[model samples]
Target: MRKQLTVITALVISFASVHAQDATIEKIREQGLTQSKVMEYAFRLTDANDSRLTNSPGYFRAANWAKNELTKLGLVNAALEPWGDFGKGWDLKKSYIAMTTPYYRPLIGFPKTWTKGTGGLKNAEIIVIKAADSAALEAYKGKLKGKIIMLHRTDTLKPTYKPDAERWSDEDLSKMAAAKMDTSRRRGGPSRNVVGSMPITTRIRKLAEAEGAIAQLS
Candidate 1:
């Protein structure tokens, strides 16, 4: 009789717990159905503000907007805290590049971050620099000034054989999740003999800047 009473008590407790959970879920569902602001929040985050590059004006605008919105919703002490000095912010207003002489054809390219703009619509000569090593950079010392330079040779475009987009299979995801840390790469860091002390591109850019090259097409 005692065992039967204990079983009955357990069932009663279980039923009460389940009923409480159901009530909580129903309240949440009702709130979502009637008071959902999903689209509003999405538009405000994306289309309402400019792109949010770190430490940029657009980033701050979105952040402040978010803070204000949260405060309106009764969040306590909603504020943005200062993160220490991040370098100056930059934004692209407009970019245009084309070949006019050979035949007026628009070239597809964007300026690199922190690169100085070519003021107004100006036509400049393009020079291709093919420096194999630091020693090879000496030949173009005085010639690069007032010119747009291509750091590397033009690549030949090839036809694509495979689909441009692909979705990962369950097996691929499982393998990725199971992947272990590559300790061998981390053990010795990087070898100096295999790689140069300073990158070739950096050296090239420094030289170009020092010599007053108008722009770089990379």
Candidate 2:
């Protein structure tokens, strides 16, 4: 009889505790739904700043703006704290690329980051090369001087009918929660040269530079 009474009392307390938590969560949900500045805050962070790479001028500007905004909201100790030094900062000023020969067309591409700028607008013939391996590179060894080389072919893109964004369903969440780590499969082994040294991607870039290729389309 005592054990039964103890179990009943414990279940009653548990039910009360659950009800209290649910009430608190509902209150929070109501408050969030009615009064939320999430969109405004998001816009201020993202739209206000063009780009915010760590230690860059844009990053510092965004940080300062955030600090000022937080201070306005009566937040204490809102200041930019110095983290350890990141590498040298760079900013993109003006970048443009285009195809002139065989009917003029504007090329849609961004300049490679942290690279030296082209002196001015350069007009060069685009040469497509297939140099997948060391032996393949030899064919274009004497070639590619002062010419823009294309390393890869253009891929055909298909339009998707599905919506770009959607909220996760309960079933989706359950599946994600129950998902197990996949550890069975192993990646393919590295390609080894005759000297047993792994041929790195840098070697190809170096070879292209040695051949006097102006710029490579990655």
Candidate 3:
């Protein structure tokens, strides 16, 4: 009788294990393991299928389409809200520049994003300047009024045709990656602000204007 009881206990344990496995699978399915189906449609609607450009008809169409679609998707009170005017927009049709000094090198540069448009026909001698603030700009203030100023520090690109890792082994790469970086680089610290800060930059720009410095090349 004891042996029979042991056999019955073993059968009960085996059935419990089988029941647990089945429950786990049911839970996974109920949790919507394939709910990634929503993401497929979502990406198509919000990104891939939408054609938009700020202030353009395509942009407007996408905006309204999104609002209407959300409303249809059981969004209780979907509405297209009017916000502040974001001003006008323009696209760069074409632009070109070349260096005529130091060497006849065709220097390559692109303006910053979201900057005021130059109407594809504006051309002037580029004046480079780097001022930390208003005062530093004063040194050449009067001069920069009509000049094409480069406000940032100019960097000459060196020819590094090969990848840096090509010159080092795996151990060297690890050592370089693990090396401590410090602030004493470039031979100067905060004192390197030759032009000064923003307010100082404005002051310097005003001074430059007074001194007849054409638009500065920062």
Best model per TM-score: 1
Kindly report which residue pairs in candidate 2 clash with one another: none
Please report how far candidate 1 places residue 115 from its true position, in Å. 2.3
Give lDDT for model 2.
Answer: 0.79
Tens-place lDDT per residue, model 2, 1-218, is 99999999999999999999999999999979988888987877777886787767778878898999999989999988878877898778887887776778887888776666667777788887765667776787777788887775446789999899999999999999999998898876655653342353466577768877778777
Give each model's whole-structure lDDT. Answer: 0.85, 0.79, 0.63
Model 1 lDDT per residue over 1-218, tens place: 99999999999999999999999999999889998898898788777888788777778888989999999999999999988998888778999989998789999998877677778876889888888687988788888888888876556889999999999999999999999987674556568744664576777888888888888887
Identify the runs in model 2 with alpha carbons over 4 angstroms from their true place.
Answer: 1-27, 154-200, 210-212
lDDT of 3: 0.63
Distance from true location, Cα of 91 in model 3, Å = 6.7
lDDT for 180 (candidate 2): 96
Ranking by lDDT: 1, 2, 3
Model 1 TM-score, 2 decimals? 0.74
What is the C-alpha local distance difference test score of candidate 1? 0.85
Task: Supply every candidate's count of residue pairs whose N, Cα or C atoms clash at under 3 angstroms.
Answer: 0, 0, 41
Clashing pairs in 1: none
**What is the C-alpha lDDT profile of model 3 across 135-162, one tens digit per residue?**
5555654556556655665568888788
Model 1: CA > 4 A from native: 1-11, 22-40, 167-198
Better of 1 and 2 by lDDT: 1
The superposed Cα distance between candidate 3 and the true structure at residue 200, in angstroms, equals 4.2
Give the least accurate 10-residue stretch of model 1, judged by summed lDDT. 185-194
